[model samples]
Target: MSGLRVIPTWRHGREWLYVCGEDGGTVAWYDREADRVSLLDEARGGDALEALRPFLVGSVAVGPPPVPTPAELAGLALHPDDDLAPNRPGEHLAVALDRDPGPPRRLRADPRRRALAAQQRVGEVLDGLEAAGWRVLHAVPLPGGTYVHHLVIGPGGLYALHTVPARGRRVRVADPFVTIGRAEPQPLLRRARADASRCSYALTAEVHPALVLVTPSSAVPPAPHLFTDTTLPTLARTGGHLKPADVEALHMLARDRGTWTRA
Candidate 1:
């Protein structure tokens, strides 16, 4: 499979880098020494992969932009889903468009307008993260469906799940199991901060840029090189761990964790 060879989201000494080769192949790496930035080892995955490439190849940084304020970080938080809570635990942050210093922004009612609105919601979430100081590395799709929006955020590399309910048919299957879920505002953020070493960073992710794998059950084995090398602080936020049953639908076109990857 000739494609991008990203370092499985990893960490160096005190920093993290998002490595990308050609296609969507990416990896996160960080350590104490030996830093190199540039594309290397272009080939199919697994055995054929060249082991000589350094982790930080060609500026492999992850997460969104950087800002430092809880209020600002609120922008990156997922839209209020009062329905799914405790697991998601907070309501301090909100997603909104940038301040244009003009008239009120409106979302049209046309089909294209609808798509634009959805994309805008996602953009607002990412923007909120940037304003709060988080380096959004790269977004990867989770296998199974387009609905499973899997993302790798921060330097330490954590799995973030974005469920686009409206795009359900576009990517995922019609699974009655996976429905809109939510996390407690405070606890979820607390968990995320602890995971990033108290670095409460940004909380937005680039929309469905790549596809991913959706494990039916924890016992099921995922594809090779499928997971990252980071330690998750809490499973409080959904999408960090792979449970086979959670995934029921998927999009055929998404590339990140897609099944279309030529191997």
Candidate 2:
């Protein structure tokens, strides 16, 4: 928000919406009531509304989660470019809400102790990303689906994870978000080799840049819109702050102090 114009408004309901733009490049909307913000930009992402916390804007204003509203889902734009490769570009509606959640949740439903096959599939991608100098912070299952994995690539590389299930019988999870359609391969414009998986193939057209290769399964649904724009690099994004206590303790130890005690 320092130089960006993020539009925050309300629809005809209990929801609040927000969208962003810089120098009026494009108009986006954030609707808290509908749990989503629409950007007039080119890229599309699901769960888009969750990122609009006041903190992200460097705003010290503390408040409650806004409500959802009834707006023209098709008119609200959330991106600046229309050529959001790897994802369908245009104004679309998602279940973006002001649903304040706890945190990155880990749900273990089955006691059978099954591992995520996507791990293997994603491992290849992570290896590629890391080999290409992308530091992965963490990976998690998307809320609306399973085949999709959310890999937190440092400072700003938060991308939608994907993989085609290896001829598996079933999806371990209930509802994994997904969207399946023919896509054209996009060239490696970023200075990388062009490759493709069995299910997720890279062609000339970049359909969903957010796409990833995951083991196919019924645990998730096909989510067509899931993306976000990031400023921080993968390494910087995953970097955490130093602990004050730890730093202080180290100082005392350096001075030949045994243990710390309060006077």
**Per-residue C-alpha lDDT of model 2 across residues 1-263, encoded as one tens digit per residue:** 23444444322113343444453343345544344444444342222334455524332222332342222322232232321111111101011112332244547432111223334434434544433323331222112232223332322322333333323343322122333223233322221111112112211112122443234333333333221112112323232432333322222221111111110
In order of appearance, the predictions have TM-scores of 0.22, 0.21
Where in model 2 is the C-alpha error above 4 Å?
1-115, 140-148, 154-156, 162-211, 215-263
Q: What is the lDDT for 24 in model 1?
A: 36
lDDT by residue for model 1 (1-263), tens: 43433332222112333344443334222332444332223232232223324433554323323442443233213122211111111111111112222344545333333333443344334333432222232222222322222233432233443312243222222222222123112222222222232111222222222212222122212322222111112222334332222111111012222122221
Q: How many residue pairs clash in each candidate?
A: 78, 88
Q: What is the lDDT of residue 38 in candidate 2?
A: 43
